[model samples]
Target: MSVRALVVDPSAPAAVRLGEVPDPVPAPGQVVVEVSHASLNYGDLNDARSGRVPVGAVLGSDAAGVVVRAAADGTGPAVGTRVVALASGAFAERVAIDTGAIAEVPEGLDLAKAVALPVAGVAALRSLRAAGSGPGRTVLITGASGGVGRFAVQLAARAGAHVIASVGSTARGEGLAELGADEVLVGLEGLERPVDVVIDSVGGSQLVAAWHLLAPGGSVQSVGWTSGEPAVFPPYATVGPAKSLTSFVIEGGAGPDLAVLAGLAAEGALTVEIGWQGAWDRFTEAAEALRGRRVSGKAVLEVSREERRAPALLPQG
Candidate 1:
C-alpha cells in the first residue's frame, strides 16, 4: 500500500508537492505512528534542492502522533500512546519511527505543540548543555527570533545564565525580554561585554562579530546558518583569547531530551510558539512563509486521517 506525503519536487515553489509514497512497514524496534502534526524547519527548505534529501522522497524530521502499531520488541511506547519523534520522512499520514527516537507526550500537552519541540528544541537544549551553561555565565543567542533562537533564549535563562537575544531587526526582538532574555538587541551592534557561551544560528558576518566578543575559554556552538552567507574572518581574528567554535548537529536518540521539553511544556514552564499552522495540503504556503522569514517560531502542518488513502503510484519530481 502507498501513502500520501509531501515529497520533494524541484519544480514546485518550495521544491515540494503533495504526492504519494509506499507505506512504511515497521521493524521489530520500530512503531508505526499515525502522524497528526508535523513541524517545519528552515533546513527542510534547503533539503528539497540541496540534494541532501533526494528528490521524490518524503521530506520531514519532526512529527507528533499516536502509535498505531507498537514495537515488536516492546521497547518504546505501546499502541495508542501519543508520542513525538525526531526521525526521517516524518511528513506523511503515518510513519515508522524507531523506539529510540520517540518520546511520549505528557498529559495536557497538545500534539501540535509537541511537534514543534523535536528539532529546534532539542538543538537548543543540547547545545546549551554542551556549552556548559549555568549560573554566572552569560549566554548570547543569535537569530533570537527564529525557532532555535527562541528556545535557546528560554532554556538558557532557565539555566540561570544571563541571556542576550540578538535578532536581525528591532521589530524581530519583540517579546524576547519577557521570555527571560536579560537583553535584546537588533543584531550584534554596540555589544562590548564578553559572553561565556554563544548559540549562533545567524552565520555570516554576524558570526564574525560574535566571535570577536567571546570571553576566554568560551564556547561558540554553531547551530545553524540561516543567513546563507559566508563568514570571512580577518587576519589575526582567530589569534585572540582561547575560545572554540564547535559545529553542531543532533546526532543521537532524542527521546530523553524530547521528554524533558514535552514535560516542561505540559507544566507551562516552556512555551511552544507556533507562528503558522494549517492543513498538510497547504504545505506550499507554509514553506513559502518560512522561507521568507515571515513565521516567527515554528510552522506546523496538521495531517488528516482522510489523507491516508494512498494512490496507485508515487509522483516523480
Candidate 2:
C-alpha cells in the first residue's frame, strides 16, 4: 500500500511536492500514526530549501493524529489513541514512531492545536526553563510573534517572569500584552531595562542585540536562527562569564514536556495561535509565508480526509 506525502525533490532544485509513497509500518517499539494536522516550523522550511533533506525523502517532523497501529512490542499508547508525535516523515499521511516520539494529545484539544505542542511548544517550555525564569525575574523573548516565541512568552510569564516580547514590526506586537508580556519592542532599541534572561529565536543582529542587553548574571538560551545569517559577538563579550549564552536544538524524547504543554493549552493558561490555517495542499503558500516572516504565530496545515482516514493495517487477534 502507498500513501500521499510531501517530499523534497532534490533533483528538481529542491522542489517540495506531494507524492505517493509506501505506507509506514511500525517497528517493535513504534506505532503507525494517521496524521490529521501538522504545523509548519522554521526548521522544516530551511530543510526544504537547503535540499539537505535528501531527494525523495518526506519532509516535516511535527504532526498530530490518531495512532491506528499499536507497537508489536505491546508498549506505548494503545490503538485509536490520538497523539502528537515527532515523526520525521510527518508531512506524509502516515508515519511510524517510537514511544519516545509521541505524547497523548490532552483532552479538549483538537489535532491542529495538538500539532503545535510537540516542537514549537516544547522548545518554548525548555527555553524558558533554561533561563531559570521565576518570580520577580525578567525575561526577554526575541521573535515573540513567531511560533516558539509566542509559547516562550506565555511560558515565561506563567513561570512568574516579567516577559518582554520583541518583534520585527510594531504591528506584530498587538495583543501581546494580553499574552502576559510586560513590554513589547518593535526592535531591541530603547531597551531601558536589561532582562534577567533572553530566549532568542531570531539570530544574527537580533541575537547580538539581545546579548548586549543581558543583565549581569543573566543568561540567553538561543534557539531558531530564522535570520538565516551567522551571529558574531565581540571577543571581549565573552570575557569573564558575567553573562552566559547557550545554543541548543530541540531534542526528541520530550513527550512528558509535550503533555504538560497540552494541558496548559487546554486550560487556556497557554495559547496556541495559528496564524494561517488551511488545507495541506496549501503548503507552498504557508511555507512562503513562514519564510517571509509574514505569519505572526504558527501556521497549521490540515491534511485532507482522504489521507488521514485511510484503512487501518493492524488486525485484531
Candidate 3:
C-alpha cells in the first residue's frame, strides 16, 4: 500500500518534500499505527537539514496514532486503541512501533495536543525530578520560552516550586508568565535570588551563568545544548560547596511518566503551547521555523486522518 509521507530526498537539492511511500508492516513485537498527528523538535530539524540519519529518513519522534496491529503475544497494544507513541520515523502515514514504546492516550484528551507532550513532557518531568523539584524549592529555568523550557516551567511550578524563568526576548517572557512562572527575567543577568533547582536547556555561557544561581545543596539539570557551545564549570566556585549538577537525556522507558503528563494535560494542569502548525507538505517550513527559534512551543505536522487505526496483526506469544 502506498501512503503519503514527508520524504527528504538526497538527490533533490530542494527542501523536504511530501510524497507517497510504502506503508509499514507489523513485525513481531511491533504494531503498525495509523498516525494522526506528529510534532517537530530540535532534533528533527537537525536531522532533516544535516541528513544525519539518511537522506530519505522519515523525521518525527513524537506522534499520536491508533494501533492497528498487535503482536500475537498481546504484550503491547490491542487493535483499535488510541495511543501516543514515541519512536523515530513518524513522518510517514504509518509507523511500525514496538509495544513497549507506546502509551495509551488518556481518556478525553485531544490526540493532536497529546502529540506535543511525549518528548518535551517526559524531559520536563525527568529534569524536575532530577532537580528535586517540590514544595518550598525555588527552581530556575533557562530558555523558558522554548518547547522543553516551557514545559519545564509549568511542571516545576505545579510541583510547588517558585519558578524563575529566563527568556531571551520580552515577547517570550510574557508568554512564560502565563505558563505559571512566578518571575520572568529577560536574561541570565536578571536573576537576583539563588534557586534550589535549575533546569538549563540553553547551554554554553548561559549554563555557566546559571551555575552561579544555584543555592547551597541545590541541583541543576542540564538537558540541551542549543547554544552551540560547551558548558564550563568554574573552580572553587559556590557551586562546589553547595551545588549539584546533573544532566537529563530522555530515552525509552519513560512511558509511565509520560502517561502522567498526558493525564495532567487531560486535567488542564499542563498547557502545551502550539507555536506553529503545518500540513505534511510544509515539512521544510516547519523545520525552518524550529531552527530559527521562531516557534515558542512545539511545531506540528498534520497527517491524514485515514492513517489513524489499530493494526490487524497481534503479537505472538
Candidate 4:
C-alpha cells in the first residue's frame, strides 16, 4: 500500500522531499480518502522551512478526494464519494479524516478547483460574519491579491456590500477588481474613506493602520499574522469607539459553512482561481513558489486524474 507523498525532513538542510509512503488507514469515526487534489497555504511554507511540522509530516491541509474506506461506527462518509476534507498531512496520496471534518462537494464542481474552497472560503465567510457586512455596508479587505483575500472580496460583495480591496502591487489590481471588489487600492495610497467592516489578513503595522479608517462601531476581523509581527492594539483608542476586534482560526467541524461555500461555487456566485498546478512529485517546488510569493490565487497538487462517483463514506454497521 505504498502511496506517493511529500515528506518534510528536518534533518535535510536544503529542501523538502517528495516520494512514497505507506497509505494511511481509517480509524473508527474516520474515513480514508484517496486524495485527488490538495492546495498549499502559507502555513505549509513555514512548516517546510522551519520544520515546525514533525519530520515526515505531510504539509497540505485542504484537499479533494475519494472515500476509500469508511469508519466502523457508520458515522463517517461512504466509500467512493467525491468529497473535500480539511486535515493536516494532506500532501499525500491518501489521508484519514474524521467524519465531522469532511464535506460532500456539490456535483459538477471541478474537484481540483474545490481543493481551494475549504480553508480560504471558510475564513472569508467567518470574517464577513464577524464584521456583519451586508446590504448598504462597506467592507474593506486587505491583502486582496492573495488566496484568502480573494475569497473575502467575493463573499463580501455577494452579500451586497461595497468592497474596497487593498493589494500589495498594481499588477494584481485588475484581478482583484474582477473578483467583485468595487475599488482596488494599490500600495495603500489615498484610502482615507471609512469602512463599516475591515477584514485584515496581512496583519502587523498594516492592521494597526487599518483600525484608524474603520467607522465608529465598525468591526475588524484579523485572521492571519503573515507579517510576522505582534499586533499592537491601542486599548484606549479601540475601546473609545466601541469597535470590535476579532481573530479567526479554522479548527474542526466547519463542514456546514464549507457546504455553504460549495453551494455558492455551484451557483457560480463564488470563483476559485487556480494560481498554479503540479504533480504530487513536484510538491516541494509548489511549496517554494508559495513561500517566494510567486503564486497568485491558490496552488494545487494534482495527486491523481481518476474521479470517483458514489456516496461519501458513512459509518459502518
Candidate 5:
C-alpha cells in the first residue's frame, strides 16, 4: 500500500508537492505514527532546491502524530499514544520514527502547536544552553520574528537573561516585550551595549555586526542563515578578544528535549506561536507565506485528524 506525502519535486513552484509513497514500515526500534501535523522550517525550503533532501524524497523534519504501531522491540510509546518527533521525511501520512526521537505529547497541547516544538524549540533550547544563558547575562537573538527567534527570546527570558530581540522592522518586533524581551530593536541600530550571548539566525552582514558587538569572552551560537547573503568581515574583524561564533545544528535524539518543551507549553511557560496553519494540501500557500516572511513564528500543516484506533495488524504467534 502507498501513503500520501509532500515529496521534493524540483520542478514544482515550491519544489515540493503531494504525492504517493510506500507506506512506512517500522523497524524494531521504530514506531509507525499516523501523522496529524507537520511543521515547516526555512531549512526545508532550501533542502528542496539545494539537493540536500534529494528529488522525489519526502521532505520534512518535525511532526506530531499518533503511533499506529509500536516498536517491535517494545522500546517506544505503545500504539495509540500521541507523540511529536524530530524525524526525517516527516511530512507524510505516516512516519516510522526511532524511539529515541519521539516524545509523548502531554495532554492539553494541540498537536498543531506541539508540531512546532521540534526543530525550532530544540534549536532554541540547545543554542541557549550552549551559549550559557542565565541571569545577569545579556542575550541577543537576531531574526526575532521568526520561529527560532521567538522561542529563543522566551527561553532566554525564562532563564533570567536580559533578552534583546533584533528584528528587520519595528512592525515585526511587536509583542516581543511581552514575550520577555527586555529590548526589541528594528535593526542593530540604537544599541550601544555589547551582549554576552548572541543567538544569531540571520547570518551575513548582521552576523558581522553582531561579532563587533560581542562582549569579551562572549559566544555567538550561529543557528540559521535566513539572510542568504555572505558575511564579509573586515581585515581585523576576528582579531579581538576571546570571543567565539559556533555553528549549530540539531543533533541526536530529540525526544527528551521535545518532552521538556511540551511540558513547558502545557504549563503555560512556553508559547508556540503558529504564524500560519492549514490543511497539508495547502502546503504551497504555507511555503510561500513562510518564504516571503509573512509568517512570523511557525507554519504548521494538518496532515490528518486524530485517530484513536490503529489499523488492524496481523497477530504474532
Candidate 6:
C-alpha cells in the first residue's frame, strides 16, 4: 500500500510537494507511527529552500502519532501508544522512527501540541542548561516569538530566571509577558541592560548586540541564524570577565528530553505555541509563513486524522 507524504524536489527549487510512497514496515528497534500531526521549524525552511536535505527526500523533522507497528525486536513502545518523535521523512501519513527517538505522549495532552516539542524543546532545554540559567539569573531570549524562543522563555522562567524577550516587532512582543517573560522589547535598542544568559536564535546583528549585552560572567547560547547573516561580534565583546559565546544544534538522540518536555506541557508548566495549523497539503503556505517570520510560534500540520484502521490502497502516482 502507498501512503501520502511531502517530498522536496531538491533541483526544482521549491519548498515541498505532496506525493505517494510505499507504506513503512518497521525494522528492528523501529516503530511505524501513523502520523497525526507535525511541527515545522525554521531549519525546515532552510532545508526546503537550499535543498540542504538529500535530493528527493521526504523532508520533515518532528511528528506525533499513534504507533501502528512496533519493532520486531520488542524494544519500541506498544503498538497503540501515542508518541512524539523526531525522525526523517516525518511529513507523511505514517513515519518509521527508531524507538530511541519516540517518547510516549503524556496523559491528557493533545498529540498536536506534543508534536511541537521534540525539536525546539530539546534545543531550548539543552541550551538553557549549557547557559547555566537558573533562579536569580537574568536570561534574555531573542526571537522570543519563535518556537525555540517561546520554549526557552518558559523553561528559563520555570528554572527561576528572570526571563526577557526580544522580538522583531512590538506587536509580536504582545502577550509574551504572560508566557513568562519579565520584559519584552522590539529590538536591542532600549534594552541595553546586560543579562546573565542570552538564548539567541536571531544571529547576525541581534547576536552581535546580545554578545555585547552579556554581563560579566555571562553566557550566550547561539542556537539559530534566522537573520541569514554572518555573526561578527567585536573582539572586546568576548573579552569581558568570564563571558562566553557558544553555538549548538539539537542533538538528535534526546527521547528522554522530549518526554520531559511533553510532561511539562501536559502539566501546564510549559506552553506549546502553535501559531498556525492546517492540513498537510497546505505545507507550502505554512512554510512561507514561517520563512517570512509571519508566524510567531510553531506552524503545525495535521498530516492525518485519527488512526488508519486499515491501510487503504490509493492510486499509484
Stretch of 10 with least lDDT, candidate 3: 308-317
lDDT of 6: 0.85
Instruction: Give candidate 4's whole-model lDDT.
Output: 0.80
lDDT of 4 at 110: 86
lDDT of 3 by residue, 196-246 (tens): 988888889888888887778988888887788876767866425756778
Off by over 4 Å in 4: 11-15, 50-52, 229-239, 304-317
- The full ranking of all candidates by TM-score, starting with the best, is 5, 1, 2, 6, 4, 3
> How well does each candidate superpose onto the true structure, as a TM-score?
0.96, 0.94, 0.89, 0.89, 0.96, 0.93
Segments of candidate 1 deviating more than 4 angstroms: 305-317
Clashes of each: 0, 0, 17, 12, 0, 0
Model 1, span 173-291: residue lDDT tens: 88889899999999888899899999999899999999999999999999999999999999999996689999999998999999999999999999899999999888989999988
Model 6, 17-83: lDDT tens digits are: 8878888766788888888899888888778767577656788889998887777787878877999
For candidate 4, write residues 182-293 as lDDT tens digits.
9999755798988899898889878987888888889888888777877686776566667777877876576788778887887788998887897866666777776666
lDDT against the true structure, each candidate: 0.91, 0.84, 0.79, 0.80, 0.92, 0.85
User: Among these predicted structures, which one has the highest TM-score?
Assistant: 5
For residues 1-317, write the lDDT of model 2, one tens digit per residue: 89888898754432688788898767788888888898888888778768668778899989988888888888789888989987677898888888887899878988888898777888888887777999999999989999998888888888888999999888988778989999998988789777899999889988887888888899999887878788788887767658888987777687778888888888888888888989888888998888888887899988875544554756633
Candidate 5: give the clashing pairs: none
C-alpha positional error of residue 302 in candidate 4 after TM-score superposition, expressed in Å: 1.0
Report the alpha-carbon TM-score of model 1 versus the true structure: 0.96
Local lDDT at 68 for model 6: 78
Q: How big is the positional error of residue 204 in model 3, measured in Å on the Cα after superposition?
A: 1.2
